[model samples]
Target chain A: MQLDVVVGFFLLGMVAQLLKAPIKMPKGLYESLTLFLLIAIGLKGGVALNSHASGDLLIQAAAIIGFGLVLPLIAFPILYKMGGLSRIDSASVAAHYGSVSVATFAVAMTVVEANGIEYEPYFPLFVALLEVPAIAVGLWLARDRNQELDLKKAAHEIFLNQGVLLLVGGLLIGWWAGARTDSLMPFFSSLFHGVLALFLLEMGRIASSQLGVLRNFGSFIASFGVLMPLVGAGLGALLAHALELSTGGVILLATLGSSASYIAVPAAMVVALPKANQSLSITASLAITFPFNVLVGIPLYSVLVGHWS
Target chain B: MKKRAFAFEMAVSFVLMALGLVLVQLGLPGYGLVVVAAILMGLSFVTRKWVAQTANVKVAAPKRGNH
Candidate 1:
């Protein structure tokens, strides 16, 4: 399978940052790019589900939820015991890994589409499903038992956070509009990769800046950051195959499973897990895992999955 | 466990995930994930126990509340 060309933008961003080249991604452009990708992805999934909903879809979604929950459980012990992080730090890191990354998923989608690989469009639905569960699991790990937990605060952060609200909202709107959206596809569907290219360029610059922090943390976070996604992607493949997803679906699921959340989870963690160092999670996710996924991991999963089946 | 040991453990975990996927493809669609999760957790518990016993050369606990 061929690597997506947009990945070049990520590398370019990193290079620009590394060279200390004067590059400013206009204020809030990153946010706008993120919003575009999120809605585009949600609309794609919503449009697919608008026609494809069935009992079987529910079963697949339930499986995706299980997939989400299981990832952090696997990650926490490693970070806590083996990596020797504090309990909250380990859980925070685990939650970051356990949750899915939209940018990574977007990369994977582009990878498959570039390869002419046909995946199920309902994947964005799975992306939405994969977002929150790990955050919930992370909150459970981070909360002090004696502390009076704010259920309302937690609910708002988890359910109505920027990522969830826009993705779910877009999904609902896409479903509501249905074929009426055909005209707008020129903007949403056609311009998606270009928008993603711009988004990744900014992400590249940002991720490059986070590297030193990950380095300071030492080898385990870096190593786990690289390897954990492989584990998640492997399980995604198995589960997708079990669900009897198409080959493209298997690739997409593996990509989704393998990614760590740099966007949604970090924001929610600030509100929910106050004691957990937000930067630690960000450094690990964005600095370590994000680049790896963007540069090497996406293609690696594709090749691995291709060889598997 | 040190970083090296943790890396080794992740390697084992990756292999276990593939093994589970193969099992699922063989016929047991529903149980493959459970099997993978079970064995991985079991591996974690066992390794941590080993790490505790060998506690001489451990990865230093991370400093917290510094974010």
Candidate 2:
């Protein structure tokens, strides 16, 4: 059932790309779609909790943050060396491994929730938080203060990017609104699932388009894109075992562990390290890793999570 | 001009965030904000080309007169 959903999205995205219809959705529309999905999930989660606080929630949130920080630290070195990329390219790619894709993570949260699995409502904030640090690390790796303009630009890119600000802002708003159940739930609650499916469809469109770029990537980069996620998942499971997280939380950690930053890191790299090979990083993230995670990584991590639980 | 460039980027980001909020508030379906971001980003790249062209023009005009 899970495999079918994953493959179904992939095929839809693939078909959309092949049609090559010039129906370029506007940037605002795409972002709003994603934001709506996230807030809806958040609100629904909030409504589910219904103001009940749990000791386990904080632990799960912490695990998300912990895995968010540590997985990239471990994953970057392997991807860098294995891909045989330069310091800048390697670092750019590595930073992506660290940051979480809120969209992808949101999708996973939806999957878990639909399965009647309990998860942390605060997990979305963790997703927002995880995006910037690896960017800082990536920038630090390519740091050359000699270029004042570039440094300034990188700072702006990190804090002020539309996606960053909105995701972070929306998460905060969702929390605030989620708390005010009487007024907010009407707008944010009912729309969660439909928005998520729509966003996933758009992602399908993107992954399909990038499929052509997979072979263009060298063996090392392509293989590393697939392999690093599994390695990261294993590390996450180990951490989950040590932390003694719940089965659901363990799966969340492993999913968080294995996912890469296609959105945030690439935007940061474009600003901070413009000379680095955009094609390599973007292609790896889009063509190889994104599909790999949605297809293979989710199930693999779920199994690990189940074992740990 | 550098400050202006910074302002430009900031303004663009603000517009995007605002647009995203409005669309969701209005009940539009599809992830519009991310797509809007990607479009504005692509548009910004085109604008950078314009800036580069203008810069080249400035450099060339002065050089031709000096020569």
Evaluated with TM-score, which candidate comes out highest?
A: 1
Q: List-wise, what DockQ does each model earn? A: 0.11, 0.02
- Which residue runs of candidate 1 sit more than 4 Å off their true CA positions? B1-67
In the predicted model 1, the residue pairs found to clash are none
Q: Distance (Å) between predicted and true CA of A254, model 1?
A: 0.6
Q: Candidate 1 residues A1-309, lDDT tens each?
A: 455899999989999999999679789888998999999999988888888889999999999999999999999987887778888898888899889999999999999889888888878999999999999998787667787778889788989999998999889888888888898799999999999999989888899888766434654566577668878888999999999998889999988888999888888888777888888889888887778677766776676666677
Worst 10 residues of 1 chain A by lDDT: A214-223
lDDT of 2 by residue, A1-309 (tens): 255354465557657788985446667777788667655544554444445447766775566566656655665665555444577777778778778666667656656766677664555555666678778777666556665446688889887776677666665555555556657666766666666666667777887777555444434455456556666767766776677655666677667667787776788779888878887777777766776667656654554355436
